[model samples]
Target chain A: MAAGEVSSLEDCLEEHLPPAVLQHVWRMLYGKDTRKLDLPKSALTASLEKDFQLKGFGFEAAIEQLRQPRVVRVGLIQNKILLPTDSPVSEQVAALQKRIADIVEVAAMCGVNIVCLQEAWTMPFAFCTREKLPWTEFAESAEDGQTTRFCQELARKYNLVIVSPILERDEFHGDTLWNTAVVISNSGKVLGKTRKNHIPRVGDFNESTYYMEGNTGHKVFQTQFGRIAVNICFGRHHPLNWLMYSINGAEIIFNPCATVGALSEPMWPIEARNAAIANHCFTCGINRVGTEHFKNEFTSADGQKAHHEFGHFYGSSYVAAPDGSRTPGLSRIEDGLLVAELDLNLCRQINDKWAFKMTGRYELYADELAEAVQPNFDPYIVTE
Target chain B: MAAGEVSSLEDCLEEHLPPAVLQHVWRMLYGKDTRKLDLPKSALTASLEKDFQLKGFGFEAAIEQLRQPRVVRVGLIQNKILLPTDSPVSEQVAALQKRIADIVEVAAMCGVNIVCLQEAWTMPFAFCTREKLPWTEFAESAEDGQTTRFCQELARKYNLVIVSPILERDEFHGDTLWNTAVVISNSGKVLGKTRKNHIPRVGDFNESTYYMEGNTGHKVFQTQFGRIAVNICFGRHHPLNWLMYSINGAEIIFNPCATVGALSEPMWPIEARNAAIANHCFTCGINRVGTEHFKNEFTSADGQKAHHEFGHFYGSSYVAAPDGSRTPGLSRIEDGLLVAELDLNLCRQINDKWAFKMTGRYELYADELAEAVQPNFDPYIVTE
Candidate 1:
C-alpha cells in the first residue's frame, strides 16, 4: 500500500487473503467479479493510444493491461464545516482547515487513496443570499492559499489525490473569484486546475453573484492513480463539458456539490451518474450532508414558502462505475465516508459493449450547429 | 386476457397457474389466508393522489383492499420501418402505412394498451445527409396525414393510446416542418401533439434538416391511463426540457430516439433515466434496432474513415420507475417486445421517499438567466 508500489492483481489477492480463503477471494476479486471486469487487450490498447495520445515503445500493450487499472479504495468526505456568520474571517479559516485535516487523518486510517471533499469545502456556500463580505474573505488563490497548503501536506502524508474545490481567488486577474477545482498530487505539488464552465444562475443556487463562468476549457490532470477531471457541481448538467473531459483522456471525474436536495434534490445523483455513464468514466459525487442554515430567506418560482436556509443536504454521496452499476451510500442524513473500489478496466469493457463514441454521427450536425450559432441565421430561410 | 376486460389480479393469477400449485400460488398472490395484505390507508390514498391525481378520492384504498391495479400488464414496441428510397412517393406511403398496421396487429395480440414508436417513425432519418427531396416528400401534416390516419385507426381498433411521432409539415408556415409527437386517443381522435423544443444540430444527428426548433413549450397530456409527455431524441439531452414537462404535470415521459450508441452511445439510457428520477415520473425510452445504410459517406471530427452509414443502432430499450429502478430490455442486436406491469403506486412511494420537486429551490437563477439571454441591441458594437 506504499506510494509508487505497483502489484499485479494475483499478487495483491495472495497477500491480502488467508490461505483458507485465498481461492475464493481471488475469484471474487479477480475472476469475473461483477465490478472489476477488464476489457480485451487489443481494444484497450487502441483506445488508450487514440484517446490518451500515449506513444512510446511497447507503451500501448503495457498501458492496455494497465488501462483497466486495479481497483483502489476511494473515500468521500461529506464535510459540513459551518462557519458562524459573525465569526472573523481568520477564525473561520482556521476552524475549517482543522476540520479538513481531521477528516484526512480518518480517511488515511481507512486506507483511502483518493478523498474528494464537498464543493467549496473551505467556506459555507453563502452565494444564495448575495453576501458580499463573505465572498471578499472566503475566496483564496489555488497555488498559495491556506486551503492548498493544508490539502498538499495531507496528500503527501497519505499519498492520496486530494480533490479540493474552492472559490478560487485569481491573483493575476484583479483578485476575481472563480469556481475552481484544484488537484493536489500525492507528492504535495499543485496539479493543474479546471474552472467550472456552466455556472448556474437559477433557484437558490445564485452562483453568478459571487463568481463568473470559468474561461478555461475542460481539462484532465494526470496523477499517480489516474488521469482525473473535475466538473464542479453545475457543469454536470452539460453533456459537452463531460465529453470534452472524456475525449481528453479522463478516466475518473469527481463532482463535488454544496447546497441541498431543496435546490436540486430531484436532479442530484442523476446529473453526476449520467455524466459518468455517458463519458465512460468512473464518477464520484460528494455532497454536503447537514442542513446548514443561511442568514437569508428567498421565495421560489411559485410563491411557496422557499428560503435560503440551505435546504436539507440529502447526503447521498455515491460512486457510479463506467458500466452504470452504482454504489449508493449514505443518503438524506449525514456524517460518514462513502467508499467504493472501482476497477478502471470497466471503462474499456463498457466502451466496447456500448461503443457510443465510435458510432456517433458528428458530421451530420457539425455544419448545422456552425450555422445555428451565427447571429440572425435562420434554418428555415429559403433563397431570396 | 381479452381486450377491454379489466381482469382482477386474482383471476389472472388463478388462470395463469395450475390447480396443483394453488396453495403456494394463493399465498404468493394474496399474501395472506384472508386473501389480502392490509396496506396503510394513507399509503393507498397517497398512491391514488400521486399516480392518478385523483384528488380526495379514496379509490386507491378501496382498490388496495380489493387488490386491484397491482399487476397490470404493459408492452413496448421498438420499430424501424425505413421510408422507401427507390419507390414512388405513393408507393413509399402505402408500404410504410401497411408496416404500421402490421405492428399494431402484433401489439394487439400482446395486449399492449400503450405502444410507443421511434421518433419520426413514418420516414427514414434523412436529416443525416440533408437530402431535401426526402424532407419534402416524407413530412406530413400532423392534423390530417397518412401517419395520423394510421395511428388513429390503430388506436380505435386496439382501444389504446398510440403515441406516434412524425415529421410535421406545418401548413400555416410556408415549407416548414416541426419535429412533432401526436398522441392519438382510443376513440380515433388526435389528443395533442408536442413539438420538440431543443433541437440538436451537433454531429450526425442532424435534426435541423427537416424540422425547426419547436416553439411550443413542454406539455403533459391527460389520458385515461395516465398523464404523459413526449420529449424527442435530441430533446433528451437538455435538463430544462424535462423540468418544463414535469412542472407542467407529466406522470410519464416517452423519449423516442432514432440515433444509436455510435454517435453518442454512452448517453443513451442515462439522459432519459435521469430526467425520470429528477422529475419523479415514469420514463420509457424506445429506440430503433439494426443498422442502416445511407446514400452518403462522411468523415468524423478527427480524420477517421467515417461513413454517413446510419450507425448500428444499439436498441437498449428500457423503462425506469420513479424510484430510479430501471429494467433495461434488449441491447443493440435484439429485436423484440419488452413487457412490464408497473405498479403506479410506486411513483408516490418514490416521491414520498425522495421529494425532490417539492423541496427544490426553483427561483434563485431567474434573474441571472434573464440577464444572460438578453439580446444586445448595441448595433454599432464591433466584434473580434
Candidate 2:
C-alpha cells in the first residue's frame, strides 16, 4: 500500500470516528487476520479430531500437525442498501463508493488481503419493480466505468484484491449488458472479470428482463494473494457452477449475492457450505442487507397487479472451510464485515484427504452430461 | 399393497409389539404419510414457506394449495454394523439379514412404501483395509446376489419398494466388481441396477483398488410409487452425480453411504440438503452406525500401520425437501429409521417457482462441459 493512501485512510478514520471506538471496530473486524490473534480451537474441530481418531498406531497426532500454519485472510463485506430506491444512479454510486472506501481502509488495517462486495452493491435492488427506465441507468462499462475506477483506487490504497460486482454495460461489444464482478489487483490493475452464468427467472428475479446469462466458461482469476473464482448470486444454486470453479483450481471462491430471506433463506445456509466441502475449497457467501420496497405494482404469477417489497435481504454472510465447518451468521440484520484466516494450504490438505476431485470420475459424468444437454435427452429410461 | 403382505405384516406386529406401543412407533415414523393423521403443520414446511415466500402478487397461497395432495412415504434405514469385521461373510450376512428383516417388519407396520438400506448393508465397510480376500467374500452377483435375493423376499413380503445397495460381482462379465444398488419393486422383482460412477481414492477409500468407477450413465428406476435413483456411497460427494439423478426424473434419490464422522460428518448434513434444493427432489442421506473395528492394521496416508476403525459411521440420517428445508437427524449413534411423507409434486412446484432447471442453460453448459471432459482441457486462458 502507498504511503499517501495509508495516510489518507488514517485521516479518514480520524475524521469519521473517535480514536477509541475506531480502534475497537478495526480490532473487531481485522483482529483475526492480524496473524498474531489466534482463534480458539472450534468445538467442531475437536469433536472431529477425537471422534475420527486414527487410534492404535496413533495417527491422530499427524492429522493435528497437518492443520497448523499456511493461512490466507479473506474479508467479506455484506453491505446494506446504501441509498433509497429512487435515488439517481450517480448519487447512489457515489454514496456506495464513499461507504466502501471507508470499509476498505478499515479492512486493510485489519490485514485483509482480499475483500468482496455484494452483487450490484452500488444501487438499490430495484429489479423487483419490473420497471426498466431508471434501473438501466445503473449499468456502466465494467472496464472503464466510474465504479471500477473507484474500486481500482481502493485496491491500490489497501494493496487488496477487490472483487467488485456490478451491473455492467459492454460498450465495446454492441452495448451488451451483464452481471459482472471485476477483479482489481493490488497494483490497481484489472486482472479479469467473471459474469453470472446462471440467471434466475422465478419470483422477484426476472433478470432475463435485464441481461442474459454469461458466456464465459467457468473462470478462475489468478491473483498474487491466491487463485480465486467468483460465482455471482444465482450461480450458487447450481452445483455444477461451483464444481467447475473448483476444477479450475480456485482455492477461495466468493459468492457476491443479493438474495432475500423469503426468496431463498432455507437454501441460503446449505449450498455454499456444501460446495465448499464437496469441492475442497473455501467459500465466502455474501448477501446485501435490508429491504427495497417498490413504488409501482407489477403483475406476477398470482395473476394480479400487486405491490410488494422485495423480500428481506438477510445479510447473514460467513466463510466456510474446505472441511465443511462454517462461521455462524456475522450479522443477520446489520451491515458487517466477516473475515477469517484461511490456511490456503487447507485446500490441498482437504483435497488430499477427500480426493473428491481425483475420484470425481469426470469422464463418466462428462459423458452422461454430454448426452443430457442434448435437445432431446430423456431423463428416465423406463423398462417394463 | 397386496392383501397377503398386509396380513403378514399385521401378523408380525400382532406377534411382536403390543397395539399401543406399535401405534406410537408407527405414528413416530409414519405419521406424516397417513393422510388421515393430519399432521400439525411441520416446522420444516412452515419454515420453508416463510423463508421462500412467492411474493409480489400473493402466489404463495397458490403454492400452498399445490402442496396439498401427492405425497409418498419413504423410509431411510441407517443400520448399525451387524457382524464382526473378521467374521465369515455368510455369518455376517445372516446376522444382518435377521436384523434387517426385523427392521423391515417394523417399517412395514409403520406404513413405509419405499425402504432403503445403507450402502453394502449386508457386510462390513472393510474397503478401508485395502485387503481383498475377506472383503471380496462380501461381493456377490447383483442379479442373483444373496443380499438382493434376501431383499427380494423382504420386498415381496412387505409389498415394499426396496433399494438394496451391495458389493456386486458380474460373474458373466469376468467377475467384474461394482458398487451397485439394485431396485426391487413391490412385486419382488429386480427392476434394474444403477452403478456408483464416482469412486473414492482418498483417506480410507482406495475403492479403485477393488472396483473401477461404474460405466452406467445416470439411470432412474420407475416404480409403482414414483421414479427413484440410487447414488451409492461415495457418489454423494459429487454434486453432478445428484444433478444427473434429478435430470433423470428421480423424485426420490437415495444416497446410501458408509461415510464416517471423522472423514465427512460436517459435509454429511450439508451436501444432500443442497442437492435436494439444487435438483428439486427429495434426498435421503443414510449412513451406517457403530464402529467397525478392523482386525488388521491398515496403512493410511498418516504414514503409519494403523489398527484404526473406519471412524464412527455417524448414523445422522435425514430427509431434505426440494426447497432445502430438512428433517432433524434421525440418530447419530443408534440404528434407526427416518421416514418422511414427501409430496412428490413439490419438485415441480419448487421448479415452477425457481425455474432453475427450466432455465439452467443446459445447452451452454453441455457445450462447455463436453469440451471440459476432453483429455487436454485447461480451465484458464492465462495472459500477461
Candidate 3:
C-alpha cells in the first residue's frame, strides 16, 4: 500500500486473469466454491452487477464455488462379488463384510463423501443357471437385512453416503425378489430404493429367474453434497433411462454393473459414456472385477461350453466428463480409486459448446419410438 | 424294362449288368446335365473345399477334372494429378495431362477394369477463399477437356474402366464454375454425376463464392452388369458410403474428394472404412482437395486462407487393405488416384460370418466421443 507501488491483489486481477484464476479467487472469498457463490438470483437484482458480469451465469458461478478449498471428497467402491455354491453362506457374508469395510476405510482415508458399491455387490451373479439355492439363500429384505445394517454402521462411522445394491425379497408380493439398490445417507438412514428397469435375458445370462423388471421410474435423491441419480445394471443401455434421470435434475448419475466377458466386455463402458454425453451429466461406471464359477454349466444347442467360465470380467472402471473425455491411465485391473479434480463448470461448458441436447431431433422419432416400446401398439391401424 | 423290375445306371456299375443297360446308360450320359456348371473361383472353392470337400487344387484341374469354377472378376484404377494452381507451369501441365492421363488410361483402365477419377476432377479446390476469376472460368471439363475425350475413347475402344470429376462451369462456381462429377463405363458411355457436397464453412465460406461440394456419392455404376464404386463429393460422412457398396464387392474402390472440412473428417472415413468390418481387397481414395488460391485476400499466415479463398493443397492418396488399420486417413486433398484390387474373394466369406471386422471398435469409443472434431487437442490427450 505504498504510493507508486503496485498492490499484489490488484496486480493479480489486472494482469488478465484466466478463468481458472478468477475461479480460485472466487473460491477463496466463498467457503464453498460451487452452488454456494453469493450472488443475486438474477443480473438485474445483483448489488454489484458490473463486478458480477465476469462470473457469467449460475452454472459458471457453481463451478467457481466448488473450486474453493474444501475437505469433502468422494470415491466410489466398484467391485464384483460372486459367491460359489460350494462356499458356506456364513463364510461368504463374513468375507463380503470384510471387503466392504476395507473399501470404506479406503474411501474415508481419501475423504470421499460417498462410496457406491456395484449392483448386487454382496451376492454372486447366480442367474446364469437358475439355481434355486443361491437365490433363496442370497436374497435379503432391505428393511431388516444384515447387509443394510452393516452399510449403515459404515456410513455413520465414515460420515459418508454408502450406496448398496442387494437382491431384495419383497414381503408384500408372493416372496418375489427385486433387483434393488438402497441409498444410505451419511447419518445412517435408508433414503429409499430404485429397482432396475430393464431385465436382460440375452445369451448365457438369465436375470429374470430371481428379479422382475423395476417398476419405479427414474428418481434423484437430494443429499448434503448434491442431487444424484442411481441407475442399476442393464438399465444403462437405454438412453431414455438417462434422459429421465437428467429431467429429474440429477447433476451426477452413478451406474454400477456386474457384467462378465465375451462380447459384453466391450460394450460395458459404452452405455455409461453415452448416457453422460447425451445428457450432459457426469457419469461413473463402476464394474465388478474378477471372475466366478457356478456349480452347474448349461449346455448350448451346439454342445459348446455354454455356461461362461464366470465370464472373464475386465475391470476397466472409468469416470467420464460431460464432454465425453475420460480420465486416461485408469486401471483396467486391480482395486484402486480413480479421482479427478473436475471443474463442474465443464458440464455447462460442454453443453454450450456442443448443444447436442438442444439440437437433438427428439420430436422426430419420439412418437415412433413410443409405439415401439409400448405393448400391443399398432401404428398402422388408423382409428379415426 | 419289365414291370416290378428297375433298370438303374448305378446298379449296372455295381453288379453284373446286361449289355443293354450299360449301352442305355452310355447313351444317357451324353446329355446336357453331364457337363459341369461354371462358377466364380471363390464361390466354387468355398463350396467344394469348405462346403463340399472337393480335392482338386489347380485351376485347370478344379475346372476340368473336379468340375469347379475359375473366373474371379476384379477392377483397378490409379489417379495422379496435382490440385490446379497458377504457379510452376510445367508442374501444372504434368498434373493435368501426362501424369493424370498416365495413371487413368495407362495404369487403371488399360484392361477391362473399373477405374475412379481424382477429386475436383477438373481444377484444384482453390476456391476455398473469396477470390474470384480463377473459379469463374470453370467449364464442362468432361466435355471440353482431354479428360472426357480420354475417358470416352478408352471406355469404348479398350472396354476400359473410367470415372471422372470435372468443373461444370455454370451459375454456381461463380458466373461459370460448377462442381461436377461424371461416371463412365467400359463402353465409353457417360453415366451422369450429381452435384452436392454442400460445404459449410463456419469460419470461412470462401467456397460458396467459388464452387459447391457435390451432393451425392450414393450411386453404384454398372458395366457389363458388374457394380462399381462411385463416391463423389464429400459423401463419406454417411456410413452408407461403405454399407451400400459392400453389400456386394461390386469389385472396386473409388473415392474422389475435394478438401475443406476439419482435418479429421476426411481422415476418419478414409482410414476407418477401408479396414472397417470386413477386409475388402482393393480400396482407393482420389483427391483434388488440396491448396492453391488467387490473391483477393492475402496477408494471412502461410497456408492460411487468402482473400482469394483457395487453400494450399495437401496431396496424399493411398491404397490399403484391412491389414493397416492405423494408417492415418489421407491428408492434403490433392489430385491423385489410388488403385488396387486383389480379389473380391478375399473379402467375401471372411467378413461374412465374422462380423467383427465390420463392427470394428465402434462400441468401444461410441459413447466416449464428443465432438468428432475438437478445436483443441487437450481433451483427447493423457495429461497424467
Candidate 4:
C-alpha cells in the first residue's frame, strides 16, 4: 500500500523530491511523536486523584477563617487602554481613568480591600517613543494630581487602600521626572511614595531618558489592611528591589509593570514567583495588556523603528503566595482584575520553615557586593 | 433532587453531626472548588501541545550543528544513597564510589564533557542525625583526599571536568571544616574549589555546627569545557549568591543540593529557573532522591524530637537554559544522570535581549545592602 500510494502521488506531481525527504514524509505520516512534554501536574497527569497527592492538598479553608483579621484581599489590575500615539495627553489619561474606575468598581464588588494599578497607569508607555515634550505633559505632581485625587476618592469611597503608579513631575525639585507609586490609605490620606529603583534601557524600553534611578530607598507603607510596598515596573526585573521591600516588613509587595509579551514574556512567569518563595512574601505581578501603536516613528539604540507598534503588554497578572501557590492569572488580551486573599501568617510559616533569610550569609554578600560594585572591581580570576 | 438527596443521606449522619459540621460537609460536597492553579500552562491541558507553547518551546535542536565548536554537553548527577546512620564511613564512601562510577560511565556514553555530583555526594546527609562523631568521620581534605583522588581518576578516565562536593576538613588551616566543591579538569588537575557560602539553620540541615560561612568570594573556575561556578546546596536559596557568580562570568552554575521535599519542594522548582532567567546564565539544579532515615533521633532548635526519617529528596534535577526553557527533569525516586547539550552563546542572546545586568542598578543596591547588613541596622521599626 505504501508503494502504491507513492505511485498514486507520483501522477499528481513529478518525483523531484529527494529519496531521503520522501522517507521523512513517510515517517511523519506514521510515526508517533517522541518529544515528551514536562508541564507539572497538568500535562501528564493520569487522574485528578494522583495530581492532588503530587501537588499536596489544596489551600485550606478552615485555617483561613481563623486568621481573617490578619488577611487582606488584595487586587491587581492589568488594564490595556489603547490610544493612538498622536492622541492628546488629556484624552489618554482620561480614557485610562475611566477604564480603571470601572475595573476598580468590579474589584470592590469582589471584596478586594487593597488595589494597585499598572505602572504609569494613567499614560501610555511612550518612553520608547523618546519624545520629551509630548510625554512630559502627562507628568503631574504626586501630591494633588488628578490621578492621586481619583485614587484617594476611590480609596475613601470603597474603603480600600489604593496604590496608584504614575509619572510624576517634581515641581519643587526643578521639575524632575520620576516613576512613582502613591499609596492612598482608606481614609483618603496621601501616604508617602516609593519610586522605582531600577529602570530599563534595553530595546524599546528607553525609560532612562525620562528618569534616573530612584533616590528613595525601599519603603513599606503602613496601611489599614496590610503593610504594602510597591516595586514599580522595571524594578520587578531586579531581585534586590523586592528583597529590600520584604526586609522592610512588606506583607504584600505589588510589582506594577508595563512590560510586553515578546520582550519580557520568558521572564515574566519566573522572577516574581522566585522572589516570593525566596524572600517569604506574597508577590503580585500586574502587567498591562493590548497593543499601543505610535504615530511617530522612533529609533531604538540599535536603530530599529521601535515606535511603530510596541509588543503586546501580556496582562497575565497573578498573586503568588509565600508557599509558592499562585492564583490563576488574568487574561492576556483583555483588561482584568485578579483578587487574592493574603494571609500574613503564611509568610511567617514559609520563613520559619525555609528560613532562607536566617540561613542567608547577608554580611558576606553585603561586603562582597559593596566591593564588586566598585569601578575597578574584578573577581573572576581563578588561581590554580 | 439536590434537596431530596441531601435529606436522604442526612437521615442517618445528620442527626449525630453538629449543625455547623453538617453544613460544612454539604458545602464540601456541592461547592465549586475555588483554589485556582496558576501554572504557566493549563491546570489540566487537553494535550501536551498547548502546554509546550505556553511554557515556551523546549530546547531547540536546529541551532546545534551551526556552532558545533561552542557547544558543551554537561551532565548533572542526582544520586540518592540511603545509608544507615550507624554505618561505617568507609563502607558508605565505597558504596557511593561504585554507584557514581557507573553513573559517570553512562554520562560519558551520553557525550557529557563536564559532570557534577549532588552536594556531599559521597555520604549520607547525616546532618539530620545530629550525631557529630559519626558524621565527622566522613570529612576529608579538599585537596588530595580520597574523594578528590576518586574524582580525579574519573575525570582522567572519562575526559570529564568533574565537580565533587564533600565535607572538607582543611587540615592546613587549623583543621577547619567547610562544605566545598572540588573542581577537577579533564587531565586530572585540581582546578580550584568554592565553599558553600550559606548554611541552613532550619529543618534537618544543621550544617552550621560543622562549617561556618565561606570566605571565598564568588569565584569562577576556567575549565576546559566552560567557565563554571559552584553554589553548593543551601546557597541556592540566596539570589545574591547566584548574582555574584553570574557577575563573575560563570557560564554554568551548578547548585548541588541535598534538600528534601516538604521543606523546599515549592522553592525547588523556582529559584534555579529564576536565577537562570534573571542572571542570563545556565543553571543546573541537582537534588538527591529517596529518603534518608536516622537511627538516633535529634532535637531541633524548637525542642522537637525532629529526627526519624527526612522528607523525600524528590530528585527532579533539571537544566534551565538562559532563555528560560528547562529540560525535562529526572526521576523523583531513582538515581539518575541528566545530560544537556548547552549552547554557550545563548547566554549572550538572553543578556543582550534582557539587558538585566546592564540595567541592574548595582551601585544603588550595593549602598542599600551595605547599610542593611550592618549589625545595628533595623528597617522593620513600626512607629504605630
The candidate scoring highest on TM-score is: 2
Worst 10 residues of 1 chain A by lDDT: A53-62
Off by over 4 Å in 2: A1-71, A298-305, B1-68, B381-384
Instruction: Tell me how each candidate scores on DockQ against the true complex.
Output: 0.07, 0.26, 0.02, 0.20
Candidate 3 structure, TM-score to reference: 0.52
The better candidate by TM-score, 1 or 2, is 2
- Tens-place lDDT per residue, model 3, A58-108, is 123133553552222445554445355469876777787876786566556
By DockQ rank, best first, the candidates go 2, 4, 1, 3
Q: TM-score for every candidate vs. truth?
A: 0.54, 0.82, 0.52, 0.80
In order, what are the TM-scores of chain A for the candidates?
0.78, 0.82, 0.75, 0.81
The parts of candidate 1 lying over 4 Å away from their true place are A1-68, A296-308, A377-384, B1-115, B118-270, B275-384
| Per-residue accuracy of model 2 over A132-202 as CA lDDT, tens digit each | 87888899888888998999988888888899999999888888879999988888988888899998887
Query: Model 1: how far is A359 from its true place, Å?
Result: 1.1
Report how far residue A314 has shifted in candidate 1, in Å. Answer: 1.2
Candidate achieving the largest DockQ: 2
How would you encode candidate 3's per-residue C-alpha lDDT over B1-384 as one tens digit per residue? 012212221232224434544332222221111222233455334333322211111111112343233232222222333443665544554456545444443333312255565665555554554556555444555444556675687667656656676666554435445566566766676765545343433234345555555444334455553455554544433232343344334434455655432332223233323323233333455444334555445533335544654433333343433222211123232222232323344344334323333323222222222222234312221010
Write down the worst ten-residue block by lDDT for model 1 chain B.
Answer: B52-61
Considering only N, C-alpha and C atoms within 3 Å, which residue pairs clash in candidate 4? none
Worst 10 residues of 4 chain A by lDDT: A1-10
Q: For candidate 1, lDDT tens digit of each residue in B69-162?
A: 6433344556554454545666766776765566555555545567777787776666777667744687888988878988888889888887
Residue-by-residue lDDT tens digits, candidate 4, A62-91: 254445637677778777665775888899
